[model samples]
Target chain A: MDWTALVLSLKLAGATTLVLLPIGVILGRVLAFHDFRGKRWVEAAITLPLVLPPTVLGYYLLIALGVASPIGQAWQALTGDTLVFSFSGLLIASVVFNLPFAIQPLQRAFEGVGQDLRHAAWVGGLSTFATFRKVELPLAWPGLLSAAVLTFTHTLGEFGVVLMVGGAIPGETRTIAVSIYDRVQAFDTAAAGIMSAFLLISAFIAIAVVYGVGARAVRLRG
Target chain B: MGWAHARCGSVAEAGPGGAGEGLAVRLRQAGPIPLSVDLACAPGQLHALVGPSGAGKTTVLKAIAGLYRPQAGHITCGPAVWFDSAAGAWLPPQDRRVGMVFQSYALFPHMSAQANVETSLAHSARTERAARALALLTQVGLADKAHRRPADLSGGEQQRVAVARALARSPGVLLLDEPFAAVDRRTRRRLQQDLAELRSSLRIPILLVTHDLDEASALADQMSVLHEGQILQTGTPEEVMRRPASERVAEILDLSPGV
Candidate 1:
């Protein structure tokens, strides 16, 4: 099976999850706790990725991060490398597309921590950062695990966005899903089958771990 | 409007043991739990705010703890001026050395009773925090269950943990909001007695918000009857019960006229 492609996918997914974790937590907290003007619009904008077709998302990213765009120019100026059809470009696409997966669960988890507990912590002399680290993090760890697993799994299996932003370039941007597609295109169904099985097993194990740990977290929070 | 007329106005009588400037509070609001409160609880005194559920009693307590801020108010405790709307001065709960027991207890569900109390010792010497937490837990008679989480403890036990956590800071002011409403009668009586004893040793102003008139009469050194966000009268519970200032006060207290 395409081992390099498998490794690339794993690295991309790991990096994306690590990059989005802190951003998701801060954004999720703001969304969960505060109510201000235009809140619904902001929520809708973040949620658009879930409903938008991967092709549409990819097309937007292609324009936003393409060589002709300001971001692409700045990226090239900073790194002396083109962004389009590169691993970095693909990584950016995966991060943007996975925002909903990482943030929605985090927001729900933060919301589960009621106002009484927060007020209690405040009166107990816990500062904002201390309260988040001590109380919010411990109580909402299940949601955090869910966010990571979902982001990783989704990145592994993504096809449309990967093909659009990250072409099947061996050992660079080529991921397991793209390799499987390339295998099928070359009439090599056997190799594609093995890669797909590997992916299936990876996803099953991830989901299983999430349920195993999430159940214990909920029980402990009681 | 005037301190001399109020029985609780003996601010200068604070003993040397009493900490700081007691608590001075004046608040006004038109909506969102409307409140017009001008009250004082001298150092070493326990003052009860007695009113119905919607009468801004808890709001007043929350305001004192820096959990809620009214539109216009001035709150000063000990040497610190907590909030002054006119001067744009305000301190968040962490900055205000106030300990509070919420109605729901609000103990960290994931932490043991001892750890929950330790959360309030944020400014203490780290090496001595555990001993101090155990001491507070012992004071509340929950030292045996120090390692038990809130869910494993009974309602009374959880409430005790909440109390221990509140006192962990050696606060300048202590606030309790319907602290006994969630516990059984036996637990309630125990907590009441504990508070009665605690006040004498704390040497800090203690404010209790409760809807139960009997609770106020039993535990409060001075009590204020509040209605529609306003203090109708402030006096000894005996004085308020025996001679309510107005018919509204008598009605609020469920006292018969001429009694």
Candidate 2:
């Protein structure tokens, strides 16, 4: 079993979780509390990336980050590099692809905490930022944890996005999911089986932690 | 007499008189029928605004707290003008420094009684915050429950902690909206006494909004009977109880003119 693939997959999932957390929180807050014209349309747009075929998202991301595209050209000029076929590109794709998995739970959690608490804090002299930080975030921890766990597991198992954007590069973009595919292609059934087992265990552990924390929050709040 | 003198001294300490000085407010919001209010609160006094639900008792408090901007009107507290339509001066809630205790108690569920009180004193030093919060909780007779979260405590305890939180900032004015409606009767009596004692000790003006006339009569030095967004009458509670301004006021006050 090549440990590097497992290690890289873990790194990618971890990084994706970290980067997506604040974005998911902000998006969840907006979706839960903010009232704006075309709010439903905006919500659908934010969540669209989730339901769209991963391969389609991957294809678009590949094109958008390819050397010929304007975004890729800008990247090339700024960092002397291209995002297409890179691990970083795979990460970006995974974050977008798994965003709703992170956002929906958080939004639901924020909604459950209700507007009354926020209104109270506002009148008590807490600023909007302070209210969110001190009251909203702490109260929504359960939802946030669940969303993060779901996103991490989803990102860890992503095949289409990684396959299309990562290009199965060894030690660079070759995650456990990609490794499993490579092993199956090379007729190495034993290695593929081992990687699959580990992936399942990791996912189970992540989900258990999420549910564990969420249940505790419910118990405390109750 | 001792308590009365102490109360008088506290009022003097609050300023020249101790209670809020000539608090007046008028609000006109945007709608087909805008909200309109005009009333004054004397110093060292508790004025109860009793009305039916949606009669805009809460709106008056929110307007005074700078939570809502009226399309037109003014609110002047003492010599300092909180909201002046002519000058376009509208102070924020923080600047107004008015303490408010909500019906839900709104004690931060994550915080213990002590911490909740401490948060009200953001500008104070950490040691002073803790000390003041502890003292306030003790004053509210919840010193033993200082470490318990709002969820862990009973409804009455949470309300007391909320009152402690409101007083932690030492605001010149206090606003309580149905503060005792959620508590049991026995607890309600204790809370009512605590509020009365607090008012007797501090000389700060209090504005209490409630649907219950009994609550209003018990807590308010002055009473303003409101219905349909209008103040029907304003006077001392005893005077209002003795003389009804109109048939409607008499009916609402649960009173009748002398036979």
Candidate 3:
């Protein structure tokens, strides 16, 4: 019933997906291709958010983006505003939390593109950038679509990190997930049930699209 | 008429002492076994590199193509120095002007046959790219199949498309790594004939890697017998067939000592 929160949640999810896609692609390509010292450490650090408790991640983000920190100080200096408890803070937190979801699938897809095709492109007189665009991107499109959808839906349902970082600013940060919790705490079970159902159905449809359409694209390519 | 005349002109310019000065590869300690190979192929010649599996045949091709950096030595194709360890000059594959046909025919699966060839003509004028791609496809007898993706093409067709795509660059050297290993005998013969015609028309140095002795004998102007990452013999097909350099070379070639 809280239309504002639903719309805000959608906006946050969209912004988070837009911000994460390119970072995910670059990180995925690096993880897929390059071999270097401490690569395992880099990989472990990237995947840490997936296994860490959401509240733990939220705790770090809160400290890191607080007015006391260097990043927060720089933001305040430039924009005359604090980063903590802001919509931008929520977007950043969601990107960090959903990174593994975006990157792992893309890494697998780039790997599936294989070195042979890249070498062939090189021998065909295509530059590295041209080859990535002409060959890797087209071949790995399904996985990229899956990554984008996963990031979007995951951010939509975000609760712990959003709750910890953004709190409950009704018009600004009270997403659908937080609104459901607020309704339940206020003993408004009817409102909570409606919001929860909406989320459940949205998640289902997003997942179905990825599986039904994305998987078919991958299969057709193979 | 313009394209055909241009093609002939390029071919004439590439003949013997022009753009077809040939490829000279002197590589050392490149792969496993401290491989050292000294080989050359002149213009208008098909030099076959015959060796058993793991004998570093593909390594030689990669070295020539600038995909593999040799520990010591140089790779010169026509007038360009692709790699020279002493000069510390190394050209990447995209800059080396070398065309390679992989054994698996590494065509872009998402691209049509024409687009696959067009990727090689990235340096060509944008207005003439499609026409040039079509001309190369026609040269390989695939003009009608230009719109077909690699998945829709047969194995022989895929190989031909790869050849056309390689030739689209007008490379100074051509490297075929087991190009016919995947097709049947009839398709293999047809592809071989097509390649022979391509060689005669292009007049560029071509180095072919094959395990089949008959294929080598039938197509190669000269054959180099390699074993354990070393060139044991280099001579005409009849010379190597009639007189292998040593017992090991003979054994590797599967030829009787008396023969």
Which has the greatest TM-score? Answer: 1
List runs of model 3 lying over 4 Å from the truth: B1-20, B30-33, B255-259
lDDT of 3: 0.86
Which digits, one per residue and each the tens of the lDDT, describe model 2 over residues A20-122? 9999999898889888999898788778877888889889888887889998898789888778778777778878888888899999999987876776676
Q: Chain B, candidate 2: TM?
A: 0.86
Best candidate per lDDT, number? 1
Candidates' DockQ values? Answer: 0.69, 0.36, 0.63
Best-fitting candidate, scored by DockQ? 1
Interface root mean square deviation per prediction = 1.1, 1.7, 1.1
**Could you give candidate 3's per-residue lDDT for residues B130-181 as a string of tens digits?**
9999998998889899999998999999999999988888899899999998
**Model 3 agreement with the true structure over A1-222: per-residue lDDT tens digits:** 999999999999999999999998999998898889998998898899889988999999999989999989999999998887889888888999998989988998898888889999998888999989999999888779889999998988989889988998987888999999999999999999999999999899989988896667666666
Clashes of each: 1, 3, 0
Q: Alpha-carbon error at B53 in model 1, in Å?
A: 2.8
Model 1 TM-score, all chains together: 0.91
lDDT of 1 by residue, A119-184 (tens): 889988899889999998888888899999999998999988998888889988899999999999
**Candidate 2's residue-wise lDDT over B98-125, tens digit each?**
7889888777778777888876787577
Please tell me which model should have the higher TM-score, number 2 or number 3. Answer: 3
TM-score of 3: 0.90
